[model samples]
Target chain A: MKAQKFWPWLIVTLGAAYFLIPLLATFIFSLRMRRNEYTFDAYVSVFSDPKFYATFGYSLSVGVFTIIVGIFVVVPAVYFVRLRMPWLRPFMEFVTLLPLVIPALVLVYGYVRLYGSSSLIPFTGSILGTDILLTCAYVMLAMPYMYRAVDNGMRTIDIGTLTEAAQIMGASQVQIIGNIILPNILVAILSGAFLTFAIVIGEFTIASLLNRPAFGPYLVGIGTNRAYEPAALAIISFIITWGAMGMINVLGRFAPRTSARTD
Target chain B: MPAFLEVQNLVKSFGTNTVVKGVNFAFAKGEFISLLGPSGCGKTTILRMIAGFERPTSGTIRVDGEDITHLKPNQRQLGMVFQAYALFPNMTVGENIAFGLKVAGMPAEQRRARVDEMLKLIGLLGFDKRYPYEMSGGQQQRVALARAIAPKPRLLLLDEPLSALDAKIRVSLREEIRAIQRDLGITTVFVTHDQEEAMSISDRIVVMNSGNIEQLGAAHDIYNRPATRFVATFVGQLNTLPAGVLAGTPGERAIRPELISLAPRPETDLTLTGTIADLHFLGSVQRLRVDIGGTLVNIDTFNNQTSPLQRGDTVTLHLAQKDLLTLGA
Candidate 1:
């Protein structure tokens, strides 16, 4: 009859296990060197290899690139649609969420068909070709998360009031967007950044299709070459992603309450 | 001589139904006017139109002889306070009050001084560092008031500012608002559903119903001589009876509860015999409901000079002819 007594603890325990199991399994796999030997050999094998550092370094660069590009592309686009062209919201939202419905691998295949060297656009022939392809794919894959975050953020404040207030004060449209609107929605932008980082770092299909040396492809390459090292790489990528997200959550704890709504 | 703010034949229709139908009024400089009506009346729509938030279907709004009907809310140079206070939750009290000045690109020192002046005016000088959530409802409203008046706009519009507050705070804040408006000598238009609030604070009250102005006059005149049946009932309590029996036309008689007195005197022009249906003791005053024929008429009498009348006693109701408003059928 007293549901409150048992339900909360039960739900928390189950939720913790749901998230912790994968982490624990990864840790256990990383620790095992042999059937009987429990050592740091896998970690050692990973750290000593010259290629592991290069691959992880490439992954880090690509993830950071993806987040920066995503922020630049998404914030203004979503703000424009939400504020000026609200009539196109349903169409824009559907287009952004289309990536979620299409599998990442299938989407990457489409990107290759559209922009790869042998495809219609032949976009990879340019000087910035490979990184460009990788960045485009990352932005596409990470769009759903970023758009939703920014849209939700924009919804919290009185957009009309903020814009009107700034405009009447002699602020141009660009200044209003940059100074007032963007700063107000900084938290959402940061959350979107963190999410984009997580997605791009873990993504494998787009990089493999485009022949880009991103972290996901690098991990897979190392996995086939060295068994224990792949586990270590997986652990490293997991830590990077988890650490970034955890930092976001912790920073979010001390964030102003208005951050959830405005910035 | 043109009025400071002029609205001519304003109309606003949502879909098929018109919320504000051909309403018009004007206000001179330093005049305090109240648009008094019940909920669903077009008082707020009219206010919004004047503030340039809503575009009228057909009309013109002129401020100081300049047409501003198509201007934006910000371009009209008017400050408005919403019913919910609408204080920016992210800003401190000082920042919230200084928002207009900050927008206006005032120098920091001048802006700071103006913020301080507004805070002192609202009696919240020490609350500058506080955020909106940290303050009580009354304090938050004072901050909102300070914010609106800080800009020193040509006209100040208040939309039910005191309705959100408790009774004691509402009275005090209303008095403070009236005092500040007087001190500033700014033209003002306040919208309220509360008749008491309008009557107590406004120099003139515009009583509206179904998107039309029922009566517009000085507060005392509006209260004393309500032009229509609805105005009589809406502005104050009234005793409505058939015209033949109630001394008025068939519609209603807007009679103040305080205006009708009870006595055994036969010299009164309006007299009726009825049983005392109920008696209520309201501290200094006693309320008696007398049943005359089938209609119940209420009367208020001072309790200090006489012993309280017991319920179920037959009493004679006496009313002055000048105190009752007779409406056209």
Candidate 2:
């Protein structure tokens, strides 16, 4: 019995170590100023650079903006398909998950063809060349995760009952969505928000393809410029992503415990 | 009071299956009516239709003579307690109770006052701040009831509200529900599969079978004079004996177990002489399975000063003619 349990855990531990080895090496490399001599020089130098700060701040703002837009677009769309037009569920789910199936770089290339200068979508000419394109691409990349999270959350409750309950109490559709449905699935939304942040913050494919001044491109640029500084930046990005996921997991634990009502 | 809520030929179907077929019933003001039946007999479906959760395939539903078949559940001002209680987990007990009123856009002060009133009414006055997960099943059901009633809806619909509870809790909460319904004098529609529950709490019982109303009337009439074979077997224990029209009616002379007497006394109108094949000795009553020719008849007798009969005993079973109901095709 002991061996049976230990074998699976040992394999998992080794699997975790395999994925984490480069991250550990990057952290150690960031800490060292010279051969095996530890110092905080790389971190201080990276923090002092305005370019690094700009990229970090830009990532945070883009993460927040992408999530807000995604929630506004996805929550009602998902709730509608789930509750009202159930016949369209499988189709809608397929469309939403299509983004995940296609490579992010391929979609970003398509975005450039559709919205770049002398492209089909003329309205793209009004916005700045890369920033708008980048934000829109980020929205596309985050669609599958955000939509599934909200959809799963909405599925856990009697959407009809909650809506009817709110309606009977004299709430409009907007109020029902905001007050009752959203509050109940707040945890799912939070998890989705963090997941979106992680994907956008460390996302390489779209940022590299678009050649935008985003965190991923900046990280790559730093990696080519100074070895230790790039390692420090990578560790910082890892910690940010880790922190977001950790907060999400803590709330996720309470979700099932409270899901009895939804049932 | 006249019928405050009237349903006319309400019908619903799914694909080829008709779950509720042309059900028409009405409830007077302050009446507690139970829609009782076995599983898949359309009891819950009827309740859902009334609550505006399910749209009828045909016919009309009217509350106070106004048609409401097209109106949404919330639009109809109907408060419903689902089988699972359907309490909001994230909200406090007070907030759950106050949800309807809050949706009604009542002022904070008025809603607070109404929540207090409801908490007292449901016997959970001190549990306002507690969430639904903190409470037991029975307690949660009570909160659901309190929430349904708090808004003072024009009608209350309870869909198998006590079915999830244990036996003891079921009885107590049922009584509590009936008491609250009585005190408030609200016209309430309750659905349940348990016949005893329907008989105990309802002023009228609508017994359904196979997507149709089998028999409906006062509980006494439904149990004592069941109109169909389905109802007879469904409502209570009944004993069947085959007799080729040695009788008045074709499906005549079927005796209920409770109405069967062991001895043929002067008051007995019908008598059957048979050999007891088996005997079951219950504390209060003895059930004797007797062989009458090729047919087996069951007779129930109350344990009074009478001695217990043996399995092989030959006896004459007596029954009142009035207790036997003749079913027709």
Candidate 3:
């Protein structure tokens, strides 16, 4: 047994070192702003910067809007697809994965071309319009995760029977979707929402090209100029991402067990 | 009296396949009716049409003299308990029961009171805060029934609500369902393939086959005097023997196992000589398979036999002419 465990343990140690070594180095370097002594001055500098709060707050709001748009767009489409047009599932999967297959840079360029100042809709002409465009792009970007999560949730419970039962009980379509469907799949929605939020927060290319003062562009701007504070910001982003993951695990435990109901 | 709910010449077709081929039936107020059939016999399709889930390809469904063929499922004021007990997993038992009432704009306090009353009706009085996933299949099905009926729907449709449960639970829950239906006096339409279930609880059964209703009558009538061969065989165990045995022409005749016995009837003229092929030792009943002239006939007798029967034993089976049913031509 000891000999059998040798290679597996070595591989696990190597993998752990691969991830932890850089993180440890970054933390050590981030604490070195006050030369010859380890200090939290880098963290304090990052906290002190006004750009940090503004860009973070902007990105957070954009992430929230993207989640909202994604839910409103992806959820119903998934519901209808799962219930009525199950044959369209392959097509939906292909469409949702298009964003991942085609890089974010390519997508934003296409968006700029379509919604430029000279275009009929001209979404990039105003700040609000540009923000709307960016949020819409984020929703599309997060579509694959949102759809898969909601669809997986749908698979757990019988939407067809539940919808029929609700309808037979005099619930309208909206009532069934709002009162019956959403609550059952809430964990799935949260999982997708957190993923979308993380993507929006750390995304670099789209926010950069769109000239939005989001956290991604701000982080890159800080990284190119400052070393210690950039490392601190990366650590903060890491925490935020991990925090979102923790929430997912916690919420996932309560994901409406498809338990005794199916029996 | 006119029917409280009427399905007039209902026909449903799915693309190239006709699921319900022009069927018609109706029932009085407070009637417990069952649509009984094998799978793919359009019983469920008919029930769905009545619930407004599946619109009939032709014909009309009217409840209380209202032509509800074109109405949406929600607008029809019908309560349906699905076989899978489609209770909302997110909601607790109380919320599930109060769902319809809430949708109909019932106030919170009133909804709570109503939910309690319904929970009490289903004998789940204090299970208000329990989510469905924490309950058994029977409990979830009861909650589903309560949810379907909380709004005081004009009609109740049960699409094999007990089919998903264990046999013992199915029997007990079915009794509970029948009791609740009687108390509520809601006109109910139940669909199931299990003939025993329909015969035990329903006031009338519509025996369906191949998207058509073969027979419709009271449970006793359907069981005793089936109008068609399909009905005769489907509703209960039927033994088809040569008509010459009954002294009626040259065709076949149908007989129920219960009607045949080892002991003679008061006027036992018809008789057959057969050797016991197999014997089933049921607790209170003994089922014997007797082979008479190369044809095996199943007969049920009370376990109290003067002399116990075994395989290869010669026995004489006696019956009356009235017991032999000459089924439909």
Candidate 4:
């Protein structure tokens, strides 16, 4: 019994060290930007750069757009599939998982090939169109996470009975989805949104290929030219991801308690 | 006048498999009817069709002489309680009860009062602010009932509502539900696989099997004079004997286990010799299995302070001719 308890604690302590040691090293290295001693110069330099704000702002806007579009498209698709077209569930799950199975570079290549200037629907013709395309790509990339989260949420509540109950209470279809279904799955949606945000903020291959000035491209550009500032930016990116996860945890507590075990 | 709720030749088929095949029944105003059957007997399908959740492939459902077969569930104005107590986990008990009233655009004050009235009716007056997860299964089911009836629907539908509760709670809650239904005098259709639950509450019990109603009548009538072999055996415990073995015509005969006895009595018209094969002690009663002429017969007798009967004991079983139910083969 004593050995059983000791093994788990030892494994956990070792795993923590394996992840945190490199992060601690990077943080210490980032502070060595001053000539002789450790200082906050690298952080200050990265924070003061105007390019940082522009790239971060662009990524933030794209993240928001992707979330809104993802929710609008996925929620209704999943809801209808569950309520009316139950036979289409396997097909829907297959489509959502396509993002995970197909590599991001391969997907972007297809987007570029199909939507280039000479194509029938030339989405890359204007900057705004390209941004829209990029947002669509993000939505696609986050498809698996978002769909699984929302679908699991829908399962935790009795969707058919709840919808029927709501309808019996004189709610229209729109009112049922918006008022009853949406609120019940809000925590799940927010968790998906935060995960999508974390993924979009640091994503590189698609944004760089699309020629967008997203945070990923900016991070890569800084890494190529500078040393300590790159480490500082990496630490900052890690903190942002951490913050997004923390937000999900905090929002989860506020969600209505479901007696059904979602796992 | 037309019956309050009339279901005529209702048929529902999914693809090629027919679930409810040409079913028909009707009841007057304020009648409490139970569609009782074993699982997968299409009792719930009939209830759902009546509630407008499933559209019948053929036939019509008329409420107060109005054909409502094609109406949506929302427009049907029927209150339904599910087996799993489908209370909204996100809402308080009060909010759940007031959902329909709020949707109907009732004022805040009236909705609150109605919610309070419903909670009081279900005997959960102080549970308005509690969420479903915080309550016991019985309490959650009562809240679900309160929520269903809060809008004063024209009809109430309960689909095996008490099956999920404990045995003790199921009995008490069913009584409470029946009392509430009577006080409101609302027409209700309850569905259950449990015969006792159906027998104790319904004004009329519709015993169903394989998508057809075997019998429909008062509880005692259905129990005492089952119209079919399915109804006789399904509604209660019975011992089916060969009609010739009991000195009757050549057919099947059904007799209640309780109607037979261990000792010969003056009321008994026929006595059979047998040896006790097994004895089961049920509360207040003892069930004995007797081997008579190479056939096993089940007899239920009252358990008293006298010495209990044991297996391998020689016994004589008594039966009255009137108690032997001759069923059509």
Question: lDDT: which candidate is best?
Answer: 3
| CA lDDT, candidate 1, residue A103 | 94
Candidate 3: regions farther than 4 A off: A261-263, B243-249
- Better by TM-score, candidate 3 or 2: 3
Superposed Cα deviation of residue A57, candidate 3 (Å): 1.0
Q: What is the C-alpha local distance difference test score of each model?
A: 0.80, 0.82, 0.91, 0.90
- Candidate 4 on B116-163: residue-level lDDT in tens? 899888889988998887888888889889989999988999999998
Which residue runs does candidate 2 get wrong by more than 4 Å?
Answer: A1-13, A34-36, A117-132, A158-171, A208-212, A256-263, B244-251, B264-266
Q: Candidate 1's residue-wise lDDT over A78-187, tens digit each?
A: 87887779999999889999888999788777766787677768877663787777787788888999999889878877666566544433446666677667766777
**Residue A115 error, candidate 2, Å:** 2.6
Candidates arranged by DockQ, highest first: 3, 4, 2, 1
Chain A TM-score of model 2 comes to: 0.88
What lDDT tens digits, residue by residue, belong to model 2 across residues B1-329?
67798989989999889999998888898999999898999988888887777889998988888899998766888888877777776788888888888878799999999999988888888999998877888888998898888888888888898888889989999999999999999999999999999999999999998889988899889888788888888887777766552244454456677777776667778777789999888878777788887678777778766565787888887777666677655
Docking class of 4: acceptable
lDDT of 2 at B162: 89
Q: How would you encode candidate 3's per-residue C-alpha lDDT over B224-318 as one tens digit per residue?
A: 98998899988889898975554544788778998899988797678898999999989798999999888889999988757888899999999
**DockQ, candidate 1, vs. native dimer:** 0.26
Q: By the lDDT metric, which is better: model 1 or model 3?
A: 3
- Off-target runs (Cα >4 Å) in candidate 4 are A1-18, A101-127, A208-211, A254-256, A260-263, B247-251, B261-268, B280-283, B303-318
